[model samples]
Target chain A: MTRRSGTAVLVAWLTLVWVGLWGSVTAANVLGGLAVALVLVRVLRPSPAGAPAVVSPPALLRFVLRFLVDLVVSSLQVARLAVGRRVELRSGIVSVQVPGASDTLLTVLADAITLTPGTLTVEVDASTATLYVHALDVGEGPEGVQRLRASLREQARAVVRAMGTAEARSHPTPLGRTGDRRREGQP
Target chain B: MRDVLSAVLMLTGVALALVAALGLVRFPDVFSRMHAATKPSTLGLLLITVGAAVRMREGGDAVALLLVAAFQFVTGPVAAHMIGRAAYRSGAGAQAGLVVDELADVSAPPA
Candidate 1:
């Protein structure tokens, strides 16, 4: 195994072991960590890469700060919804085309959406680089869909940027007449 | 004050868990029920775990509690993703509110 791949495997293994050790000081826990680490290392068997280990501490810090901000904001938003009076929430699902984003960025965005209240990631299509998010409290009519799309676009951008990726310049995926199915006359 | 805080967290966690269970039982659809169950349950579990960790005077138990929290942090999203994907593919999410899924390209039958 090349050194780069070996290091990647080592990092994953070490993280698992650390998690195990950090969980409990008991002998059993320590042993468990060792066991888990061994299994993880074998399973991942990461391939080595030629790219130098780029240490971007600033990027890492930014990522952490972004995550914390999302956590607090989403928590408060969800709490308010959970407690406040019902206001006839206009919920809808919109798929945003996210172009030029890596797999890692996509996963992070999906996770962030799921963690946040009033939103869930229903699906991601890597082929077209689009993500479908189910949103709660979208306002009524065409305006609402536009707003919902914008909000998801903004949040998804934040997630990708936090992971140190460049802004996605992808075009919006075309949806047929079924895209905006809601109408003023529809029941 | 600490004891009071612990009691509150414990009660809140239990309440959330019960609400989640209720949602799972009463909700007509899987997606909505999953929405109800995942978020509150995760928050409740985290808060309760933290409370317990704080109450633990010993180092070992505290470490264990931290570990549990970390595990939840990693696994919660994974489990949610798995369930959501399963539901979407199984045609259970057809009734979901407001979606523009273009995954038809990816879902094409394997060549």
Candidate 2:
């Protein structure tokens, strides 16, 4: 409940990692981990200006569950794509506008997308609040591109809802519309 | 019964790792290759760790295995993120038949 609880969490996680790497949980290992974790937390503490948003536990749980499902599904999809004889690799970059998200949230969103199969985050343009994602199979053409953009936007929105502040939710941009319009005008 | 379960888990883990290795060789591009490298490999490693923990049947070992899984979960995405960024910056994605270039405007200086 204290302000240092966040650091405590980081310390606990680091301690666990240390124990895991050591492959034992002896008293010495635990004490060493604790000492290391404390020093690390002190040295690498987050700045007040870059404080993470208060996460909604229920929303975060939902997001995690859905993300797990997506991970399994996409892994299978990628596996199939890799092995399939007809390699229809329509790889492309799609831009998504995510307004009101903090730096932490935006980085989380990019990491999530990259971790999922068939997609990688290419660039994050902070000025325009845009994320460029490279997808393995963007499908046929403009319609397929629109569908991918919509899904990516939805994923971004879910992350925002789970971990973003009310200010972020208020200034919502129209999902996929701007990109869709631009694609439509393309020959 | 425990032995049987451990054997099954180990076999499944090995199978997954083999598939991941196959995908690494068979996949055409770096982005797709990265996809093959991260997800299944992490799951495979977790499953193998769990199988070993089950066989060990020691509380401390189990806890250690759990920690291993947790660390893998934390680091896998980070590693993938870095690799993807490097590949994109190096124009590997474009060489792999990239259809659209949304980041062209922003990432132009690097290329």
Candidate 3:
């Protein structure tokens, strides 16, 4: 993968944020923003270790479109559930394994899931690369959990596809634990 | 036309904020409460900021409003995630009506 221009991108984004906060785009503001962004980037840059993931613009666009749709649909779902006469929610924590993803991508995926209405990411087991997600509906039995797991797998796959490199996508990892199948039958 | 649009946006934003408040009171558990707190509030804030920018129509004001909205979008999820993690660790998920506790193994030692 090509080396990421992290510094340039960070500086530009910070400058935009700076201008937005100041509510002005004058030369003085822009210059001050550049100075601040430069300092911030120096302070906040991640250690140079693993190569950064190259984001595919097309995949990123698709991810954004799908996320918007999910956002609206889930918001309405939660709103209805909240205001419904009988609020019957079968919530469960489901562990999803997102293999080969960088720390940044995993955090992004977790944030995206939490931002969605019905699901909140409760924990990220960095050791195992597992995300513990609390879903609003896990159905009646194992089947429900399985279904949710499948959907979460799809979400994780979408994220990896959108942002991961060609190598990371090829060696795809199993999304959930096989042992979960047994526990699914219990509750 | 601008005034009408701004009025509509502001009213909708206020309504969303009201719904978010209702959810905060109505939802049973911390996780669900978080669902209420983040999504609708973020959307409401965005709508209100957009409305304010439209009403002001000044370059600086508009830019500032947009920046506020952007910051909210970025920080809202991060804050929600941290709160959710804290709740999960504290056994808040054990509240009645919670169906499954997959993180039981992870949280057991903490409590």
Top DockQ hit = 3
**lDDT (tens digit, per residue) of candidate 1 on B6-54:** 7888787776666556656654456656666666677678778877877
Q: Candidate 3 on B1-111: residue-level lDDT in tens?
A: 999988998898887788788888898788888888877777788889999889895888887887788889888888888888888777665673567777775566143
Task: Please rank every candidate by DockQ, starting with the best.
Answer: 3, 2, 1
How big is the RMSD of model 1? Answer: 6.9
Indicate the worst ten consecutive residues by lDDT in candidate 3 chain B: B102-111
Query: Local error of candidate 1 at A1, Å?
Result: 19
Candidate 1, residues A1-187, lDDT tens digits: the string is 2355556657666755475566545666556666766676679865433222323467557766766566555555555555555445555556666566656566777877777766777777666556766665567776777777676666765554444233342323322222322321221
Candidate 2 ranges beyond 4 A from true positions? A1-5, A18-35, A125-129, A173-187, B109-111
Over the true interface residues, superposed, what is the Cα RMSD of model 2?
2.4
Ranking by TM-score: 3, 2, 1
Candidate 3 runs further than 4 Å off: A1-4, A48-50, A173-187, B109-111
Task: Report the Cα lDDT for candidate 3.
Answer: 0.76
Q: What is the C-alpha lDDT of each candidate?
A: 0.61, 0.74, 0.76
In candidate 1, list every pair of residues with a backbone clash.
A5-A48, A23-B63, A23-B64, A93-B98
* DockQ list for all candidates: 0.30, 0.55, 0.67
**How is the predicted docking of candidate 1 categorized under the CAPRI scheme?**
acceptable
